[model samples]
Target: MNIVVRDTLEAAEAAHVAVKQAAGLAAEEAALPFKQARLRAEEAMRNNLTQAKVLATRVGRLKQQALEMARESQAAQRQNSTTDAHRMQDSARELMKEAQELESQAKGFQRMAEATRGGLGIYALRAKAAATRAAQRVNPGGDGPLLLPPPPPPLRPAPRGSAK
Candidate 1:
């Protein structure tokens, strides 16, 4: 009889442990998507940074080319060329302007990448906070969540015959 009772207790304990293990696994599985999304966002930020670097390099080269072209146009005028020097000057100025615009755009993309990285940091912090809150809800102790208190209720309407 004692052997039978011990076997029953051991079986119950094993089942309980299995259930808890399964619950923990389920929680981890549910959080997997969030973890994947966070990683993707981080990768996207990195890609944006890389693209910005490439754009900056292109802009620099474009500016250098424009400057060289402008110098060549000036040297042509000195060589007593009969072509329209003013037209060449105007073309050089326009190319330089476009290059400057491209540089500005590259800077803008760099700023966007920086902002996205910041946002990812904030997102990670928020996810951790939310997970902590959920754990607190389940356990209610052991480094409780730093949750804020609920807001007060709205004012009720006065009764129809209430004093003014």
Candidate 2:
């Protein structure tokens, strides 16, 4: 799982102002691009979810087929034939597990996309804050009291393979 920083007043206010800065689509002309963006994003997400469902369905079919094979193997075993029911049973179980994993992965990706989209405001704020910090550092004391809000803490790096 990812460890996100808890929002402090500094980060929160930056995000608030950033939202304000990104707003104001008064003109219908100004809104066209935004509307197109919204549509594109939604379409991509829909397609992704559809593909995930298709893959999950395939996995489910594989699981059912495995179960059918297991049943047939058991029937053969009952007739004193040399079919390994245990192997078929294990394969069926593994296929079932694969189906569950596929579903879980799809859900996780969906949430991640949502979070990243929602975090774009924060991303914009971060860009402004970084610029402000650089300006202040280079021209310290010379600039007439920059009234910029304090820069946010650096984002922590996610651990490798951590978001499983």
Candidate 3:
């Protein structure tokens, strides 16, 4: 009779532990989708950032090319040569078209980046709001800014030959 009771107690303890472990596993499984969504959102944000960098570089190169073309056209005009003017204008027009196309493409990238960033912002805000609500429930007086302020603008060098 003593041996039977000991066996029964051991079985009951084992069953309770198994149920607890199963509950923990189920909770983790439920959270898996949220974790995956967050990861995917982060990946999209990173891709947008990379695309923005590439577009910015391309836009800079295009602007440089446009400036060079304008300088050539100006030199041709100053020389009072019809042939030079025609050649320079044609070259300038071609460069202008290329530059315009690059600008448009860059704008498209900018829009995409903005959209991705906006989506991430909304997701983060929702998560923050949820966390805040949970925290308020746990401790009725916690207060803090959920979002950080924007960064300061970059400083640039002064122009050459400009007055102080």
Best by lDDT: 1
Q: What tens-digit string does per-residue lDDT give for candidate 3 at 1-164?
A: 34444455556657655655554455455545555677787787778677767877877786777778778878878888768877777877777777678777767776776786677656555555555455455434333222223323442333444443
**Per-model TM values vs. the true structure:** 0.68, 0.44, 0.58
For each candidate, C-alpha RMSD in Å? 17.7, 21.9, 24.7
Highest-scoring model, TM-score: 1
Measured on C-alpha atoms, candidate 1 has an lDDT of 0.66
Ten-residue stretch with the least lDDT total in model 2: 20-29
lDDT of 3: 0.62
Q: Cα deviation of 107 in candidate 1 (Å)?
A: 1.3
**Candidate 2 runs further than 4 Å off:** 1-26, 80-83, 106-164
Cα lDDT listed for each candidate: 0.66, 0.58, 0.62
Clashing pairs in 3: none
Candidate 1 scores a C-alpha RMSD against the true structure in Å of 17.7
